[model samples]
Target: MRFTIGKLAKATDVLVTTIRYYESIGLLDEPDRSESGQRLYTEDAVERLAFIRHARDLGFPVETIRELIALQVDPGQDCERVDEIARHQLGEVQRRIAQLKSLETELKRMLSSCEAGKIASCSVLAALGHHEGCLHDEHGGQEVLAKPPSI
Candidate 1:
């Protein structure tokens, strides 16, 4: 069955705009157009879109996905390259998890020490105000902010 972009987005839990953006970047090939010029997607197209979205959800960039798609097309080729890509992505995910755990520790320390004291003299403020220091290092880790930025 053919699907329109809206239907594809709903089925895949990806935004319509993101699907179009992927097409723009060549990560997803543009779908065929009907006589009315409406884009028509086949089952294969939908599956490919799902694959692209899944890879993006796992933090793989479009460029890498493009390569993976090519590797997927050539049946004679070994899938070892795909495994390497997955391994790299896994390593990256693990690194982020570790960084988040470290930041969580620092945040717990900062929050518990506050003691509900005056805002100006709060331990939370003291922790944040330390020059040249943070739960995340100057360069390493997720660098979580103590608070969200003002809108």
Candidate 2:
């Protein structure tokens, strides 16, 4: 079935702006325009949008998704490349999990030290003010800790 941009977005559960952005970024191809200039999409667009949504939900970057789309178009390509990308994403996820676990540990330590006094004596505030007071030495020393949102 054919769909307008709105229908496509609704069908794929992706926002219209995001779909337009994807098109601008070359992630989604520009669809044919209707008689009055409205964008028209087909079943293939639905499938492609679904793939893009799923990849994004899995935390795959746009460039990686583009590569995967390229691979999808070329059926004869070796699956090894796809596997490599997935493995890389897995490693990143594992690393983040480890980092979150460390953060959890540090938070617990900070909370445990709190004696329910004023903000001056609050362990959480003290830790925030003085990183050196943290029980975990590696708490804020990593480069990742300084970086903004990655995924």
Candidate 3:
């Protein structure tokens, strides 16, 4: 059965703007327009949107998802390609986990160093202002006081 954009969004639990953005980005196909200009979708769109949502939830980038969709369309493609993508994503996740763990350790050290004194004597503030004074030598003498952006 045909469904409008709103219905599709409701059924897929995705926002209407996200759906439109996906279409604009070539991740989702442009649906048929109704007589009054409403977009009409079908079961295929629902299934595709679900796949997209699942990939997104798994942290796959849009470009990677586009490659996966291309592979899905071609039954002859080797499964190795998909495996490679997943493996790369796994490596990235591992790297981020390592970074987060380091951050946690550094935060703990800073917090523990605090003696409940005024801000002038706060170890946390001191560490923040002077990265060289960090307890750990993980950065090999380089400053790493600021948190890195998420991957």
lDDT for model 3 comes to 0.83
Reference-based lDDT, each prediction:
0.76, 0.84, 0.83
Select the stronger candidate by lDDT from 2 and 3. 2
**Cα TM-score per model:** 0.84, 0.88, 0.85
User: Model 1 scores what on Cα lDDT?
Assistant: 0.76
lDDT of 2 by residue, 10-71 (tens): 89988898999889999889999989999999899899999999988777888999999999
Off by over 4 Å in 2: 137-151
Root-mean-square deviation of every model: 4.2, 3.2, 4.5
lDDT of candidate 1 at residue 142, scale 0 to 100 = 36
Whole-model alpha-carbon lDDT for candidate 2: 0.84
Where is model 3 more than 4 Å wrong at Cα? 135-151
